[model samples]
Target: MKKIPVLFILVLLLAFWGCSQKEKKVSVKKVGPIDPQMVQDQDDMTWEDYKPIPEISWADPSIKPKRGFKMALVAVDFPDQPFVITQPKGSDLFGNPQIDPIKREDVAQFYRDFFIKPSDVNHGQTINGYWMEQSRGEFGITEVDAYGPYQLPKNLWEYGLNEWGQNDFTPDGSKPKGRMERDVDSLWRAEYGDLRKNYDAILRIYASYDETGVWQEFGEMKFNSKEDIPPEWGNPNPDKPRWVATRYVPWTSWKAGAMQWGISSIRQGENSGTITHELGHYAFRIGDNNNNPYVEPYRRAGSGPWDMMDRGCFNGPGGPHKRWVVPAIAGASMPAGLMVRNRMKNDFLTEDDILRLSRDSLAVTGLAVANITARAVEPFEGEYAGVIVELDGEEPHDRTPVDDPAENPLSPGIPNYDYYSLEVVQRIGYDSYCPDNGVLLAKNRDKESRNGGVNQFNCFNWVIDAHPEDINMVDYDKPNGEKVMRTIADYRQLNDALFHAGLNSGSEFEYDDPYNRLHFYIIDLHRNQEGILSYTIGVKSLDGSGAAKRDFQLTAPKTTKESVALFTLKNKDKKAGLDASCFDNDIYRLAVSTEGEGLKAEILNELAVVSSGEEISIPVYFSEEDGEKSDVRITLTAVSESDPSKKMEASYVIP
Candidate 1:
């Protein structure tokens, strides 16, 4: 009797299990960008055909010539104290000299060899690849001495601290940051002003100071204590981490004067990569590609290891921090290269270099393919013109920055904005620092706006990111499981997150415009043996009228049924002519199959002509004589006549 009850209990448990299986998550087709005009209907769905555009007549302004661009290398120091090249040994309280006190010519020779000499490792490419390519070998950079060691009018921190009140040194007070530029200029004029016109730009280099000396100088200033010094001044180690002054970017309209360039002061015997970064600003009129390190959520990445304009300048064998060691080949390790957007802006690439296609055009054409090369290397004629797939639509405009603390505010112009951009990113050349290899799609507003609180020219350029929540991808300082506040360590993580296309075939990226007039899709991604990345993309237009299109989607079954499996088919087209009998060349063929015995497949509408507002049902039945214990598997495929490879599928199991 107990065994009979146990058997009944087992049957009851099995019945409950069968019912629970019906609630499983339905599998939907993952497709790239979807058109907004298409909607799910009872029996059918409308889909648009997407293909690459042949070409776009890009009209970027021609790059200004930088030929004969001479830069003066001035070795300046404080009064009476001669500049000494001090190399630090591990944990040493004081720095030890690597060589005898060097003169201005030594510094000049160091830069000449660093920039002009071809690197054996990087295919004989010179460190000055960015400038050389833009100048086409016509540019000349001259290095000169600023005579004797130029003396500062006051202590290094004093000139700048005086600009801020005692309270301003506090955490919440305004951090008068740019005042150092004034001190740099004042010292320059007192010493090198007479020789100013001798070069197109002036680079002032300084030696690193010991931590004790730095803290002492800060203490002497009216500022409270060492606490008031910029966090960049904090010694990395108590002993001798070496006191490399922060790299000040080049500014044309600096308080000191125009055409003034400054580099991050390095360890006495070390060289500099900051020069190349500053040059990007001075020579090209381009803004810094890096995020403001002093801002909040400190790990946010700016461009992440991709473009010369971003963190790629820090690319090398180890990383940016590793360059601090002496006998270092690390400083100029992976000298960065330009990205497509920067290339286009600099006029380094012409319209002939890019292929521009419209969403409407792709819908008319069936399918297209592109064999693209890495953007870092020179293009091979037409491997891929910077891919510009356009979704013809518009959305309401609101340009207010999310965080801007400026006193005077600017209006975000444009009642409505049209047009956007997409580009590919691969790990090649300087871009070896990039985190992944895939398509980098972004929203590029056709208008320009200053990055509000950041006060940068390139603020308008925004990259859509796939992982905004992950801070480790682009940040240097880690939070280490502590409450995040607006401390220097926390704020500097502000970065511009960029969205990438799906990493593989099973994944897809779909983006609909804010106004719902268009769709952008990253159909597929592939990487070749040469380490080049190629992206397949589709853009769909949602405007009222263009061409009639059909999209197919299978609504996967949730649970097991007795012997019959049922599926829903939807048509999303808006054309008026779509109806049940429209199948001549635009018919959808349904194919059904099953894995288990006794399960017979039957399609109610094998070659159904699904209209825009129609819906169809498909059922696969199993014979009762096959037995109740058999588990059946079923699949339904919908193929369109427009494109044979373009299909959608749904699967289910019957127990």
Candidate 2:
């Protein structure tokens, strides 16, 4: 072989090394705001198609008020359990009686204003305010009058120590005293004869703790076990154990476990009670959306902390565990706002406020896309407060598999659901204490009673959990040093159920139910200048593609950072070609792969929503934890959400 110059060989090696070391310049295009007008209008679709899901009517129409109404507030005190307001500061286990003793009239006025008027004590939150805001001023308490702090005939324990096992521990070992309503009502009638008929609703505020608030706090939470409960916390009968059987859990402190949890039938409440939740029962005739959260045969919560009817009533500064605090300033203080289902059930939402679609019609129309404003506020003109996709065509609309909750608490339960409701929940207004903000999607039954069967759990609204895996949160530490994990039935389990748009957003953007033949997508999120959240959502039948074409073009990838590459995916559908009457946006599912040893790649967002002529920038990150860094190739794949067959791929080499 002819001899080659050593210098020439050296130069060749140097040039090759330089070429391998060269950096690729990446240009990131700024994605603009999605135009609200781009979303298709379903004007051609009428409400008649929504016949499958009929309008919700109150069980008792007489109580459904559409205008301002009068409310009466009556205060009562027990000989044994004086009003917490009359006790010294820090008198109870929860450091209750946060204030010094006050006159009975002052206490009555405090509660009256707390329920009817906005005051600094209630943080400007009131039952009337909640109703007015929830009803959009369609209804509220026009007038509120406070009555006497009439003393009850029986001792507080007579009424409080009745439920659970307290009956066996009564002073004489007889059934705990009953007829709290009859006693209080008689007292009120004698003092203000027939005045009860003047008010639209009557609220009886009693002194002492609401069992729901103190049950766990003074029971299992304070003691290691039933056997460990001390005499001080026991019933009046010293021979009887202090612990007693209670709902959901096996045992709790007798003092609290058996106390009557604020009742709504008689509109009775306590100092540390969720009056809003009770009002939901008394005023709207809505049943509890909560599920059994403490015992075996674990079942998931219904709406969880996202709806006031559920454990969302326990929303506040300290979560459910801190509900024992008095002055009602901690947990259960600020309840979550009503969800779309409850709002509709209570006649709060208008006909035009919701975009209704029939599941059967979706198969013919392809897909429906619209923007929904947050449930906390009124929607803008041409916008909807929510989207309802009714399961229309078949005899069995919900095709979800019947799974045993006892085996897996996360099971979807009996599948006799009637429709799906999609709404946005933002941490604003009454929802300020809600855990998160995103798309709230749920499978709902038209009739609340239909939620019972295999699981025997009653739930009318079943929220779809985006992250179903156990969150592994510790509820509280037992006195014996054991860690009690929050059960699958715990309402907080749904804390991460809301779906958010884009990849790596810690939530899924879309939910696909092949059995139900539906695909729901949270395409993009937007916040107006007022800090209100809204989402551009799309729904399509898995059986067919919508009227809009699903096509996109992915640009060549470029690296802005050593291990980061950016790609712009643009919708190929021509805006001019779209039918003005019914157009649909396109959703793209992205995937990233790496071709090199010890190299790993990830895409910032696994999904993107691109409208006609619109584009989105996707970021891919590369990492090499081991082995020497070398040239690596990254492939980016984009698949159309509406039409999986339509796909595109691009690649970039990082040195």
The prediction achieving the highest TM-score against the true structure is 2
TM-score of 2: 0.83
Lowest-sum lDDT 10-residue window in model 2? 35-44
**Which tens-of-lDDT digit does each residue in 413-518 have in candidate 1?**
2222233456665544444444444555544444344443433434433444544433433322222333323222211121223333422222235556545345
Per-residue alpha-carbon lDDT of candidate 2 for residues 385-499, written as tens digits (9 for 90 to 100): 9999998886788888777666877775778888899998876666767777788999888877635544456678889888888767888888888998888788888888898
Deviation of model 1 at 596, angstroms: 4.1
Instruction: Pick the lDDT winner.
Output: 2
Give the clash total for candidate 1: 35
Residue 459 Cα positional deviation in candidate 1, in Å, after optimal superposition? 0.7
Report per-prediction Cα RMSD to one decimal.
15.3, 11.7
